[model samples]
Structure formats: C-alpha cells, structure tokens
Target chain A: MPAIVTTGITKSFGAGETRTSVLRGVDFEAEAGEMTFLVGPSGCGKTTFISILSALLSADGGALSVFGTEPNRLKSGDLVRFRRDMVGFVFQQFNLLPALDAAENVAVPLIIQGVSPRKARQRACAWLELLGLGAHLGKLPSELSGGQQQRVAIARALIHEPRLLVCDEPTASLDAETGRQVIELLREVSLNPERAAIIVTHDDRIYPYADRIAFMADGRLTHVERPDPARIPARPIRGETQP
Target chain B: MLGIALKMLFGDIVKMLGLVMGIAFSTLLMAQQGGFFIGLISRAANTVTEAQGVAIWVMDPKTETAEGPTAMRDVELYRVRGVEGVRQASPLVQATTTLRTPQGRSSAAAFLGVDDASLLGINPRFVVGSPEDLRRPDAIALDQLGFSRLWPGEPLATGKEIEVNDRRATVVAITEALPGFTAPVIVYTRLSQALSYVPGGRNRLSFILVEAEPGRDPRAIAQAISAQTGLLALTTPEFQRRTIDYVLNNTGIAPSFGVVIALGAVVGILVTGLTFTLFVNDNLKQFAVLKAMGLSNWRLLGMVLAQALVVAFIGYAIGLWIASGFFDAVNQPFSDLKGFWLPWQIAVMVAGATAVIVSLASLIAIRRVLRLDPATVFRG
Candidate 1:
C-alpha cells in the first residue's frame, strides 16, 4: 500500500462570483522508501494537495488516505492527532521559530507529542547531529545561514520519526550547491523501507535527487517523470554529505 | 506547545517589554488612584477615630457625618446616659472656629469638647503639659498638628496664646493627635469652654459619646440608645461608614475620584488591549505556522492567554510595589493625609483590573489566532 493515496481530491476558495477552484480531481500516491517530488509552478495547488495529505487541510471532495487511514474521514481532533503523530512538514521558507535555538526548534514536534523536554532535546540533538548540524545546535534561526536554517527545518520535520514526511519546496531558499546538499541530505536521512519523504518543488536542479517527480498544472497532475536508470545513484546515501 | 508559546512571547524582547509596561502602567494607575481616593475618604472619619473611648456615637437623625453633626438638646445626653449598657455618656461638643496666630495669620481650627472631669472624648498623648492645664483661664490643649498651624515651627512650650474666634485662647499643652478633616489643628477644651467659644442655642451638644460597659456589645448598646432617645446612633465602625457615605453622596468627591479611577482603567485597557492586538497581528504568520503544525484552536487560545498572564503577573506586582511606595511617601500623620492606608480591597481591585485588562486585550488576538488560515504558511 502507498504511504499516501488521494483519489479525485478537489478544493476551492472564495464564493459566489469570485469563487475559484484550485484543485480538480488530482490523484496521487507517494511510495514508502522513495522520495517522491510533487513539482509544479506557483498556484498549481501543490501546497493544497500536500496539505490535504498531511491532514492540515480537508479536501472539499475526495477519498484520501494517509497510511491506510482516510484523513478526510477522521474527526477534527483525530485529524490533528493524525497530522501530529503520523506526518511531519517542511516548509519552503524554512519556518523555524526565530526565538528558539536549533535544538529547541527541532524538539518542537516531540514536545507537541508529550515527550519530556529533556528527552525531547536529547532526541533533537541526535537528529541535528545526523543532519550535519551538531555544532550549530545552540544557534538561533537568525544566527544561522539560510542553508543551516533549512537543515533545522528538516530536522524538525524528521524529529518525531513520522511515517510520511512532507516537504513544500524545502530547498526553495538555498543556492545551487546548498539546495543540492539539502536534497541529498533529505534523501539520505529521511527515506527508508518503513518511512517515506514527499517534496513539492519546481527547482529543476534538485530533480535528480528524487526517485520520481510528479508535474502539476492548473491544480491537476500532468505527468510523473523518472530519472534515466544510468544516472541513478548506484546506492542510497546513508550519512553526511559535505556541502 | 506551552513552551513554544512562551518562547514565542519572550523571543521578541521589545514587544514583550512593551506589553509588560502597558499592563504595569494600567495596574499602577488603578491601584494608585484608588489608594489616594481611599486615603481621602477615610479622612472623613478622623474625629471618630480620635475619640478612642467612645464605642457608640449618638447624634440627631439629621446628622450624617461627624463633621456635620447638628446640635442636639443637652437633655438628650441624660437619655443616652440612661441606656442599659452605657457605662458613661458624655456631652461632647465639636465646632470649627478660626484660630488667629499672634502674627495675624488666621486658619480654621476644630475644637473638641470633653467632660473636664472624665476627659472621655478628648483622649490624646500629651507632648507638653498635662490635661488638667486646660482648666486654666481660656486655656486649650492643642494637638501637635494644631500647634504647628497656630504657631508654625514653634516648640511645644506652653503659654502660647492665640485668638479663638476673636477671643483669647491660650495653648496650655501640646497633644499629638491625627489631624481632623476640617482642620489640621484641633483644640481640646472643657465642654463649657467650647460652648463659650461658639455662638449657639441651648442645645449645644453635638454628640453624646457613650462607652459600652466592659464585655458589652457596642452594636446592641447603640440600638438601645437610638430606641430610647429617638436619636440616630451608630457604632464606631457604622459611624465611620456613615461619614464615608456622607462624603460619597453629598460632595463632589465620589464622582471626582470615580472618574479618575475609571479613566485610569479605561486608558489602561485601551492601551494594553491595542498593544496586545497589534503584537498578535504583527506575528500572524507565526500563528499560521503553528496552526499548520496541527495545534488546536484551543491550544492557540491558551497560548495567547498564557502570554497575557505573564504580562499581567509581572505588571501587577511592579505596579502595586510602586503604589505602596507612593502611599508611604504621603502618609504623614502631622499633615492632612493622616490615617491613609492602602487596604487589601485596593490590591484586589488592581488584581481584578489586571485580569480584565489581560482578557480584554487578548480577545482580538485569540479570535484572530483561532480563525487563522493554516494554509497561509504556504503563501510566501
């Protein structure tokens, strides 16, 4: 079974004369152990679709299931719990809380899950170290570079060890080299046989890092593209990659 | 989540301090103005407090305050003295007259008349001379406060004669007494001497100060005095309330102080409320992110309330400290602001106002955070 499956998911905004549809019958699936990329131009409903899959937004119409549970059918409170316990999100702007140091920011998900703060910080420290941010754990978001900030956001997303990790243009803020380093880091640290990573991006530079890329337009999935077999990495990356 | 809320609130040092200052000023305004009002009104009961030996105060039905007591028939004292629990009932005279110093500077002075033999209504600690000295010709025992007004910066030495209502009045002794509301300096004299100074009819007795026998309830004795003499009677506490009530209802004092106290609360609420709302609106995106992170609207509301609570707690403590210090600075017994105290009610008032200001100020923020679009995090 796919980690996330959406059939005929529809969403719209506004009302009356100004009403506009954003998503029209988009069917998508993200597979476990693979980093699936949902790539589209601005206003293509990529965020909305991933938001539905993450249980952050309810689709106006759909049959949506995240890890065999239909998020659309869950109660509002249970939907929040589903999002908190089963999914993690990485935003495009690297939305780390400016007040907290990297370790505290990464510990947010665990704290929300009722983990003791000391244990949460320890787990956050381990994850931050895994993402090559061990030395920067005490630095605030403003004190770090954009690349370091994005790594912190990634660490926050992965800290709770959710089955499905969702990224909204996670590398959108980084430079060419930094974006490559972040995508490679995500591929190495997040994806496994039991857990999956889904990224929404239009950055052609990071396309090779994704196992598959879904292209969208006008709120509908156009097609999915895969890398040439010869260009694929010989094996998955498991540890730190120097930028 | 609570930790995150706290971090977010304190992260912006300037904003947090601004919020705390707003709350603190509000608390200070309410507490301090209320203290002054409390201090001012409590002065109306100065004479009642000065008469320590009197447990029950008997006056005419028309009399509302000690300062405005109408003279009752002298025979009324005999009726009050006849009451069952009354150990003694003294005919007390209270009148305000002008005291002309030797230098020709004249100021209003209150004269308290007591029974010469018993000295029931005019008990005070003597600074110079003795109570018996008042029996001398035209002699008066002046309060230390009155002594200062009569002869400014003069020592407590006796034989300082001053004109009372254009007649010779000698300051035979100096007695330290908290100044009365009508005048800072009060003259303690015999009942006949007080009656001679003020022009009046046969009924010159202002009050019949009664003492309840040992172990007797003053409230019951007061009731018996009123029923027997057909006069209004009140225990000390009840008389104090009557005095305060008279000031509140008849004079411009209540409205004057009420406006200031109410204005302080209004301005505090507006300022703190606006600042709190502005702070939340400025960080709308952060709330959106939290919402996107699956925080419930209830949790979001709790976060804003928590921020409000921190501000209220810090502000109230600091504001009350300053208000208490203000009271300390103005509490001069020799001056007119005697008997001024910040009661616990004022603290409760400040705390109650703080809670209200916090809740009102955070209402908009709470509503906005509750309705925030979690999808807004996707924009920009």
Candidate 2:
C-alpha cells in the first residue's frame, strides 16, 4: 500500500480577483519503502503539494490519505496528532531553532508527544551519534556548518520514528559534496518497508537517489519517471555514509 | 516546549533585559510613589498616632483634623473627665508657632502643650536628655528635626536656648518625633508654658485626650463623651482615619500620586508590550517552525504567556528590591522621610498591577503568534 495517496487535490491563495490558484487538481502517490522526489520550478506548487501531503496545510478540495487514514477528514486536534505521530519534515533552510543545541532541536517532536526531556534527549543523542554528529550535540545551530545543520535537521525529522518523512530542498543550502552525503544518509537511515520519504527539490544532483520522481508544473502533476538503473550510483554516495 | 520557549526568550539577552527593565521601571514608580503618598498623608494623622496610650480625643464639634483644632473651653476638659468610662481626661494643645534660633533665623514649628502633670499627648522617643527633664524651669523638648532647624550642623544636646514667640524657651531635651504635615519641627512644653507662647482667648484648651477605663470599649466611650459634652469625640484609630481622610479629600496629594501611579502602569504596558512584540517578531520563523512540527495554537499561546510571566517575575522582583531599599535607607531617626514605608499591601497591589501590565503586553505578541501560519517555515 502507498504511504500517501491524493486524488484531485486543489488549493489557492487570496480571494476574488486577487486570488491565485497554486494547486489545480493534482493527483499523486508515494508508496512505502521508497524515496519519492517532487521536482519542479519555483511557483509550480511543489512546496504547496508537499505542505498538504504532510498535513502542515489543508487542500481546499481533495481526497487524501496517508497510511490508509484520510488526513482531510481528521478533526483539528486529530490532525495535529496525526502530524505529530506520523509525519517528519526537513526544510531547505534547515529550520533548527537557533537557541537550541543539536540534541534539543532533535528532541522536539518526542517532547511534543509528551516524552520526558531527559529520555527524549537520550534518544536524540543516539540519533545524532548515528549521523556522525555525536561530538556536536551541544553545539547550537549557529555554530554548525551547512552539512552539520542539515544532518541535525534529519535527525530531528526521524527522531519520533514517523511513518512519513518530508523534505523540502533539504540539501539546497549545502555544497555538492555535502549534499550527496546528506542524501546518502537519508537513503540509508530513513527508508524502509514501513516508512517513506518525499523530497521536494530543485537540485538535480541528488536526483538519482530517489526511487520515483514526480514532476509538477503550472499547479499540476505533469509526469512521473524512474531513474535509469545505470545512472543510479551502485557504490556508497560518500565515504562517511551512515549505516 | 516550555523550556524551549524560555530558552528562546532568554536567548537574546538584550531584549530580555529590556523587557525586565520595562517591568522594573513601572513597578518602582508605582510602589515608590504609593509609599510616598501614604507617608505624606499619614503625616496628617501623626499627632493622633503619637498620642501613645490616649484611647479617645474630645474636641470642638467643628474640629476636623489633628493639624487644625478649634479650641474648646477649659471647662470642656473637666466635662470630658466627668463622662462615663473616662479614666482620665488631660488637656492637650495643638498649635503652630514661629521659632527663632540664636542665629536670628526662624522656621514655623508645630507646638504641643501637654498636661502639666501627666504629659499625656507628647510621647517622645528621646534622642538626647530624658522626658523627666521637661519639668525644669522654662524647659521644652525640641524634636530632632526642630533642633536641626534651630541649630544647623550642630550635634544634638540639651540646654539649647530657642525663642518661641519671643519667649525664652530652653530646649532641655531632644526628642524623636514624626514630621507633621503643616511643619517639620515639633516643640513640646507644659500647657502653662504653651499658653504663654500662643496668643489666644482664655479658652485655651485645644483637645482633651481621654483614656477609657479598663475593659471599656474606646469607641463606645468616645460616643458617650460626645453625647455628654456635645463635642466630636473619636477613638484613636477613628481620629487617625478622620485626619487622613481630611487630607486626602482636601488636598491634591492623592490625585498627584494617582497620576504617577497610573503613568507607571501605562509605561509598563507600553514598554513591556512593545518589546515583547518586537521580540516575537524577530523570532517569527522559529515559532512558525514549531507550529509546523505539530504544536497546537493553544500550546503556542502558553509558550508566549510563560515567557511573559518570567519577565514579569524578574522585573517585579528587581523593582521591589529597589523600592524597599529606598524605604529602608531613608526611614531613619532624623530623616524627613522617616514616616514613609512600602506597605506590604501596596507591594502586593503593585504586584497585581505588574501582572496586569504583563498580560496586556503579552496580548500583542500572542496575537502575532496565533495569527502566524506554519507554512511560512516552508516558504524559506
């Protein structure tokens, strides 16, 4: 079964003459156990589509389900819980709180779910260690480099073991080498038969890591493609890739 | 979440201090102004409070305050002594006179003439000499403030000669007395000596200090005294309230202090509210990120409120400490500010006002956070 499936989802902004429709009846699907990339130009509704898919936003009209549960039908409170327990997000800018050290930033989702801070931080420490950030757990986001910050964002996203992980230009801020390492880490640590990731990206360098890629344009899903097997890297994408 | 909220608030040390200072400034203004006002008005009743063991006062029916009493006939003192429950009724005089130093300078002084035998009204906390020394020939006790006025820069001593209305009066003792509303200096002398200093008719009695018989209610005794003598008689606390009420109702002191207190609250709200809003505006992206992470609007609101309360607590504590220190530093034996105090009641009331200021200030920041959309995090 697919982790998320949407049919004829639509969304818009403003009202009357000023209103601009951002999503025009889009249909899409992301199956479990694989990475799906939503790629398009700016203003093409890629971020808006992922926003709705992760329950950060609601579609004006849609039939939407993640892991067999319809998100569009959930009440306000239930939708919050649905997002808290099932979805993880990594932003292009690596939206880690400036005041929080790495471990505290990574512990946020579990803390949101009423986990004691000490235990949440313990789990966060383990995750950061797994991502080669064990020594940097006490460092604030400002003290981190781009690659280090992105890894912290990934650890934060995966800390609660959510069923769906969403990334919006996660490596857009990193250099080519760091971007490849971050994508390899995501592939190794986040993808499994019970969970999936959907990345919205403008960077094509990390394109081969996705199992399926959906292209969006003018608020519509224009096409879907699977990367050629020979083009996909057979070896580890970087030397320091985590297990 | 709460920890995150506090960490976020304290992350910017400058803004947090600005917030704390806003609250502290207002708290200090309200509390300090309130204490001074209370101290100023209470001076009007200082005479009533200082009459130590006197339980009731019997005066002319028109006498409205301790500072200005309409003289009653000396017979009225005897009449009050005859009332039921009257243990003893002593003649007490209240009047203001000019005192001249040997240096030929002068300041207006509040003059009290106590009973020749009992010295009922002028209960002095002596700084030098003894109360018994008042019985010496041509002797008078000068208050510490009055002595400073007459003999500037001189150490307190007995036997300082001062002139009261051209009468040679020797200050045989220096006494500690609360500064009064009409004058800073106080002179205590025998009734006969006081009568010699002030020019008035044969009816020289100002007020009759009454001590109720043991186990008798002073309020009821006061009522009996008023009924028997057709004078206004009041228990000590009742008379103190009457005197303070007269000042509060008749003078602009209350409203002047009131304006300052109100301005304190307004300034607190403006400073705290504007700073908190700016702080929240600066951290808008962070709040949006939290919102996107599945935190509810209610939780976000709580975080803002918690941040506000922390600022309020620290600011109020700092303000209270400074205000209390002001009261402590000046309320000394000879300081003109001796009678002023920060009442715990005023402290508590200011705290309540601080809470109100913080809540009003937090509203702006809270509104911004609540109206924020989580998708803004995705935008960047």
Candidate 3:
C-alpha cells in the first residue's frame, strides 16, 4: 500500500468576499521506499499541501490516509498519537533549538515517546554518530555549519523511526554544495520499503535526488515525472533501505 | 519535556531575573513593613508591658488609650483594693512633666509613680544604679532611653541632675526601659515625689493597678471593680488590645502600611504580567513549533506551570532570606525596630499571594499560546 493517499482534498481560508482557496479538490499519492519532491512557484499550494499531509493543518473536505489510517476518521487524541508515532517533519529553517546541543535536539522525539532519558540520549548519540556528527554532538545549532545543522534536523526527524517523513524546503537556506550534501544525507539515511520521505523544494539543482518530482500549481497537482537514470548524472540507488 | 521547559526558562537569563526580582521585591516589602507596623502598635501598650505584676487596671471611665492621663482621686485606690478577689492593689500614677536642662532647655518627660513600699511597677532590668536608689530623697531612676532623649550628648550615669516642674531632682539611677511611641523620656520615682513633680488638683492617682489572688479569675474581679467603683476596670490583655486598637483607629499607621503592602502586591502582578507577556511573544514561534510536533495542549499547560513554580520558588526563597537578614541587622532592645519580627503567618500569607501573582501572569500568557495554530510555523 502507498504510504500516503489524498483524494479530492479541499482547504480554503477566509469567509465571503475575501475567501480564497489554497488547495482545491486535489488527489495525490506517495509510495514507500522513495523520496517524492513537491515543487512549484512560490504562491502555489506546495506548502499548504505539505502542511495538510504533515497533519499540521485540517482539510476542509475529502479523505486523507497515512499507513492505511484515515486522518479525518481519527479523534483529536488519536490524531496526535498518529502524528507522534508515524510522522516526522523537517523545516527549511533547520528548526533545531538553539538552546539544545545537537544530540539533545535529536533526542526530543524519543523523549516525547516516553523513553527513558539516558536511553534516548544514547540512541540520539548513535544516530548522530551514524551521520558522522559524533565529534560535534554537543554543539548547538548556531555553532554548527549549515550542512551539519541540517543533518541534526534529519536525525531529529528520523530518531523515533517514524514511517513517514515530510520536509518543507529543507535545503532552501544552504549553499549549493551543503544543500547537495544534506539531500544526499536524507536520501542515504531515511528511504526504505516500509517508510517514505517527501521534500518540498524550489531548488531545481536538487531534483536528481528524488525518485519522482510532482508539480503543483493553483492548489492542484498537475504532473509527476521520473528522472531517467541513464540520461541524468543523478546517482543511481544502490539499495532500498537505509545503510 | 520538563527539562526543555526549564532550559527555555533559564536560558533567558535577563528576563528570568526580571521575573524573580519582581516577586522578591514585593514579598520583602510586604513582610518587612508589616513587621514594623506590628512593632509600632505594640509599643503603644508599653505602659501595660512594664507593669509586670499587675493583671487588672483601674482607670477613669473616659480614658480610652493606655497613655491617657485621666487622674483619679487618692481614695479610689482603697475602693479598688476592697474588691473581691483583689490580692494587692497599688495606686499608680503616669503623668507627663517637663525636665529643665542645664541650658534652660525643656522637654516633656513621662513621670511614673510606683507604690513606695513594694515598687511593684518598676522595671526589673537596670543598667546603672539599683532599684533601691529610686527611694532616696528627690531621687529618680531615669531610663537610659529617656536620658538620651532628654540629653542627646550626655552620658548615662547615676549623678546627673535635672529640674522637674522647677523643683530640684536628681537622676540617681539609669534603668533599662523600652521607649514608647507616646513617651520617650521615662522617669520612675516615688508616688509622693511624682505628686510633687506633676501638678494635679485633688486627683493624683492615674490608675489603680490590681493583682488578682491565685485561683481567681482576673476578668471577674475587673468586672466587679468596674461595677463597684464606677471606673473602667480591664484585664491586662484587654487593655493592651484597646491601646493597639486606638492606635489603629485614631492614627493612620494601620491604613498607611496597608496601602504600601497592597501597592507591593499590585506592583508584583504588573511587573510579572508585562514581562511574562513579552517573553511569550518572543517565544511564540517556538511554542508553535512544539505544538506542531504534537505536544498535547495538556502537556503544554504542565510545562507552563512548571516554569512558574521554578520562578516562584527562587524568588520567594531569596525574598524571605533578605527580609530575615535585615530584621536581624536592625532589631535591638531600645531601637525603633524592637519587638519587630517576620511572623510565619505573614510569610505564609505572602507565599500564597506570590503564588497567585505568578499563576495569573503565567495563565494569561498561556491562554494566548493555547489558541495559536501550530500551522503558524508554516507561514513564518
């Protein structure tokens, strides 16, 4: 089964004359073991769609499902649990708290899972080590380079081993090389047959990292394209699971 | 989760101090000033405090305060003595007179007369000559506080001489006596000598101090004395309360302290309210981020309360310590702050008030945060 499925989803803001539709009757789906890129112009509904899928926003109508559970059917508490246990998020701002060191920031998800603090920190350290950040585990977000900070954000998102990861313009603030490194890290560390990752970006330079790039405009999904490995210089996938 | 909340609270060092200081200042001011007010009112009853062996007081019907100099006829003492349950009745006199300084300067002095045989009303504590020295001819025992008030530069000695009511008098002893709000210069002399020093026509007895016999109720004896003698007879505790009540009602001291203490609480609330709201605004985005991470609203409320508790505990502890330190520094036997104390009742009251102030400030900020959409982070 697909990791996420949205059928005729609709979301709007304001009332009467000032009313505007941000997402209008959109149907979209994302599969497991793949990185799906959502892209379009700035005012397109890319962020609105990503927010709805991340369970941060409620859809005005239609059905949405993640891991075969329809979100609209879940109560508020169950929805919170679903998001907590199954979904993770990465932000463009690298929203790692400046007050916490990299390891502690990554440990937040496990802490929220009611894991013991010592064990959670140990798991966080292990994850940071896997990403080559063992020497910088104690550095705060402000003290790290852009690529390292993004790596910490990715570690935080994957720490609880959530099945679906949604990233919003994750490389928007980094330079080209750092952005490439961060995208490669996400691709290397997150995709698997039982899990999926989504990146919403306007950076065409990172397009080769996605298995499929979906185009959005005027709150509607218009097209999706798969890159040809024989044609593009994009690194071909070597495995279906995280290393 | 609580660790994150605490880290957020303590990381902002400047604002955390601002919050703690606001509550601490209010607590300190309320406790310290309240102690002084209590001390001042207690001093209004200094006459009753110094008369140790007497349990009942007989004064004129119209006398309302402890320091009122309503005189009674000399025969009234015998009448009070005849009351049932009265073990020993002493005719006591408390009157104000003037002492003439060597420079011809005059200041009002409190003239106190005791029973010549027993000296029952004299303060037992003395710093210079003994109590017997007060019995010599034209001899007087002036309190060290009075000596200092009457002669600011003079040394406390046994031989200083002053003129009372233009008559020759000598300070034969220096005794320890707490200065009262009404009478700062206290002079203890014999009843006959005070009669000469203070001029009163036909009525010289200021009060008939009575001691009830053992196994007898003083209140019943006081009532019988009042009914038989047509004078106001009151137990010591009752008279002390009346004096304190007089100070509270007739003087503005009670309301004045009340206004200051009330202002302290209000200022505490305002300081915390403004700063906490500002802190919330600065961290609003972070709250949205937390909410987006699926932290339930209930858990967020817990985090807010945890922060408030931490601030309240630190602030209240420091405020209490500083007030205690200040009281220890200034409290002395004869100083203005004598009998001053930060009572535990007042401390508990201040603590309750501090909790209220802290809770109100935190709840106001939390209300705004709870209504925010976690999706707001998507926009910013």
Candidate 4:
C-alpha cells in the first residue's frame, strides 16, 4: 500500500453564502520509498494539499489516509500522536523556533513524542551529522546561514524517522545550489524502504531528485512524469534504501 | 512545559516587574491597613482583655465603659458574693482626676480606689509599686508613664508628694507603664479616700469586680449579679463588645479605615487589571506561537495564570516585608500601640485578588491566542 493516499479530497474556507473553494476533488498518492515532487505556481493549492495530506487540515469532502489510517477518524490526542510519530514537515521559510538552538529545533518532533531531552538531542545530533550539520547544532536559527538553517530544517524533518515526510516549497527560499543540496538530502532520507516523501515546490532545480514528478495548475494535477534514468545515473544506495 | 512557562514568563521581565510593583504596593497597603484596623479593634478591647481574670464587672445599667461614669451600690459586693460560683467581689471607685506635675498639671487621670485584695485585676506590669502600696491611707500608686508625665526628669521616689483633684496625696509607690484610655491611673485607697478627693453621691461605687470559681462561666455570674443587684453586670467578652460598639459608634476610625480599605481594593483591581492587560497585549504573538506549537487551550491559560501567580507572590512578599518594618519602627517607642499582623488568611486574600485581576486582564489575549492559525507560522 502507498504511504499516503487522498481520493477526491476537497476543501473550502468560510461558511454559508460566502465560501471559496481552495482544493477541488484532488486525488494523489505517495508510494513507499519514492521521492515525489509537486510543482505548481502560487495559489495552485499545492501547500493546501500537503496540509491535508499531513492531517493539519481536515478535508471538506472525500477521504485522506496516511499509512492506511484515516486521518480524520483519529481523536484529537491520537491525531496529535499520529502527527508526532508518523509525519515530519519541512516548510519553505525554515520555521525554526527562535528560542531554541539548531539541535533543539531538530529534536522538536521527538520532544513532541515525549522523548527525554537528552535522547532527543542525541537523535537530533545524529541526523544533523547525516545532513553535514554536526558543527552547527549549537547555533541558534538566527546565528546560522540561510543554507545552514535550511539544512537544519531538513535534519529536523528526518530526525524522527517519520513514515512520511512532507515539504511545502522547502527549497523555494534557498539559492539553486543550496536547493539542490536540500533535494539530495530529502531524496536520501526518503530512499529507505519504510519511508516516503512528497515535496511541493515552484523551483525546477530539484526535479532531478524525484523518482516521480507531478505537476499541478489551478488546483488540479495536470501530469505525472517519471525520472529519465537514461539522463542521470543512480548512485549506490546506503542506509535503509528500498530494493 | 514548566520550563517553557518559566522562560516565557521571564522573557518580558520589565512588564512583569511593573505588574509585580503594582500588585506589591496594593497588597502591602491591604495587609498593613487590615492589620492596623484589627490591631485597633483589639486595642479597644484590650482594657477588658488584659484583665480577663476578672469574671464580672457591675456598672450603672445606663451605658458601657469609657462612656460616662456607671455608679453602682458600694454594698453590692456583698450581694455578688452570695451568688453561686462567686469566689469574691470587690468594690472599687474609679474616677478621673487631675495630676499636678512640674511640666504642668495633666487632666483625665484614672484614679482607682481599691483595697489590697482587689488588686487581682491590675496587670502586674505596673512596675513602680506593688498592689500593697494602696493599703496606706494616704498612699497612691502612679503609673511610671504617668510619673514621667508628672515629674519629668525628677526621680519617682517613694513618698513623693502629688496632688489629685486638688487633694494632696503622696506617691507611696510609683507604678510603671499603665496608661488607660480615659486617664493615667493612680491606684489609691478604698471608696472613702477616693470620694474624699473627688466626692460624688453617697453609697455609690464606680463598679464592682467579681471573681468566679475555676471553669465557671462569667456569663452566668454576670446574669446572677444583674438579677440580684439590679445593676448591669458584664462578662469580659460582653464588655469588650460594648467597648467596640462605643468605638464604632463614637469614633471616626471605622469610617476612615473603611474608606481606606475600599480604596485599596479598588486601586488594586484597576491597577493590576490595566497593567496585566498591557503585558498580555505585548506578548500576544508569543502566546500565538505557543498555541501553534501544540499547547492545549487550558495549558496556555495555565501559562498566563502562572505568570500572574508569580507576580502576586513576589509582590506580596516585598510589600508585607516593608509594611512590617514600617509598623515596627513607627509603633516601637509607643509600646502600648500594637503592630500589624499579616496572617495567612489576609495573605491568601491579597494573592487571590491579584490572581483574579490578572486573569480577567488576560481574557482578551487568551481569545486571540486560541484563534491563531498554525498555518500562519508557515506563511512567514
């Protein structure tokens, strides 16, 4: 089964006689171990789609299931636990808590899951090292470079080993080279047999990292494109890569 | 979570300091005023309380003590002794007399004509002479405070001569520090001597002092004395209530303190409420961030309340400390004046008021926080 599936999902803001639809019968899926890319112009409902898929927004109609569990059926506390335990989100602006250092930001998911600070920090440090950010763990978000902060955001998203990783324009704020590096990290983290990732971005530079690319326009998926294996060679997989 | 709450609380230290100061000033005022008011009430009753060993006092049925004189039959002591639980009854003539002093003659002195046996009601703190000094026909015992007022720098020696109501009397023994509200008391001989100096009607004594058997109710003795003697007999508590009623009805203290207490409470509510409202407004964004970070609505409320509690506690501590020092320093030389007492109940009241004011102030900010969109955190 796919890691995430949304069938004919729709969302609207406001009520009775004053409503505007943001998403219209959107159907999408992210298979395990695949890096899926969602590319669309602004206001195309890409971000809203990711929000729904991550259970942050309730669908106005139809259904959304993450890892076979219907997101809306979970109780509030169970929903929080589900989000904390099974999903990791990376935002475009690198939304790190200003009061916390880089390692603390990365450990947020584990902390939300009630892990001890020491163990959370240990896990955060390991992920930071994996993302080539070991030396930047102690620096606050304000003290880090834009690229370094984005790498911290990436590390945070992957630190808890969430079953599905969701990114909303994660590289839209970074330079081309930095954006490529982030895309590489997302691809590597999602390559594990038990995990999947869906990244929504306007930037085209990260397209090469996706196993399958879906294009969205005016709140609808227009096309799906698989990577051209002939144009780029795949590297020897490490960690828990899928077969 | 507690750490998060503490860090958030301390993040706006300046605003919190303002809140603390406001609460502290109000709490201190409340504690001090309440303590003083209670102390004043106790003082009004101190005349009876300090002489709690005396079971009953027989007075003219017209009014309470400290009013005008209450003349009762001088022979009523015999009738009082006949009652059950009656141990002894002593007749004393209490009158206000003038004392001639070097500085000038002072008026409104409380002169008591007591036999040696009736000295049981006098507080032993009266230092200059023992109760036996009243045994001499011409002897008088002047309180040490009264002695200071009378003689000034001169030594209060035994056999020193002083005038009472223009009648010559010798200070056979000088008692120490016993100043009553009506006058500075000078204990002299029995009803005859007191009448000779300040003569009133015949066969009348100012009041009768009654003692009862151990564990006997003073109330029962007082009732019996009134039934038999046809005079107003009062237990210590009854007399104290009468004294309080006199003070409340006659003195300006109750209204004055009432106004002050009311103003303190109003100022506390307004100042604390306004200051806390401003503080919450200043930190609304931080509250939004916390809410977005998955803190429940109740948890967010707890955080604001925690801040309020910390402010109230710290302010109360500082205010009470200062009030205690001020009360002690001011009432020190005048030891007769009782100092303020900040009991736990008053502390709780002050703290609780502060918390309520702060919580009311935070309602607007809490509403704003609960409505925040976590999606906004992604926007910027």
Best candidate, TM-score: 2
What tens digits encode model 4's per-residue C-alpha lDDT throughout A125-203?
8888877888888888889988899888878777777887888888888888887777776776556767788888777
Please give the distance, in angstroms, between residue B290's alpha carbon in candidate 4 and its true position after superposition: 5.4
lDDT value, candidate 2, whole model: 0.90
Residues A161-185 of candidate 3 have per-residue lDDT tens digits of: 8888999889998999999888988
Scored by DockQ, the top model is 2
- Local accuracy of candidate 1 as per-residue lDDT tens digits, A1-243: 887788999999899999989999899888888888888888999998888888778899979877889988899899878877888888889888888899999998888778998999999998888788899999999999988998899888888878888888888888989988888778877877767788899898878777888999998999988877576554465423211
* lDDT (Cα, tens digit) per residue for candidate 4, span B175-273: 543345555343545555777777677755766778888888889888988898788889877887887888788888888887887677677667777
Q: Please state the CAPRI-style docking class of candidate 4.
A: incorrect
What Cα-based lDDT does every candidate model obtain?
A: 0.83, 0.90, 0.84, 0.71
Candidate 2, backbone clash total: 0
Model 1 global lDDT (CA atoms, 0 to 1): 0.83
Task: Mark the regions of model 3 whose C-alpha exceeds 4 Å error after superposition.
Answer: A230-243, B97-109, B127-130, B147-157, B167-176, B184-187
lDDT of 1 at A82: 82
Q: What's the DockQ of model 3? A: 0.59
lDDT of 1 by residue, B1-380 (tens): 77777888899888888888887787888887788788777777878987878899999999989888998998898888888999998888998888887888777878888887788877567888888888888988887666666566766679887887667888888887766666666788998788888777888989988889999999999988888889998998999999989888888887987888788788778878888888898778888877777677888888888888988898888888888887787776465565566788999988998898788888878898888978788778
Worst 10 residues of 3 chain B by lDDT: B330-339
Which order, best to worst by TM-score? 2, 1, 3, 4
List pairs with backbone clashes in candidate 3.
none
Q: What level of docking quality does candidate 1 show?
A: medium
User: Which 10 residues in a row give candidate 1 chain A its minimum summed lDDT?
Assistant: A234-243
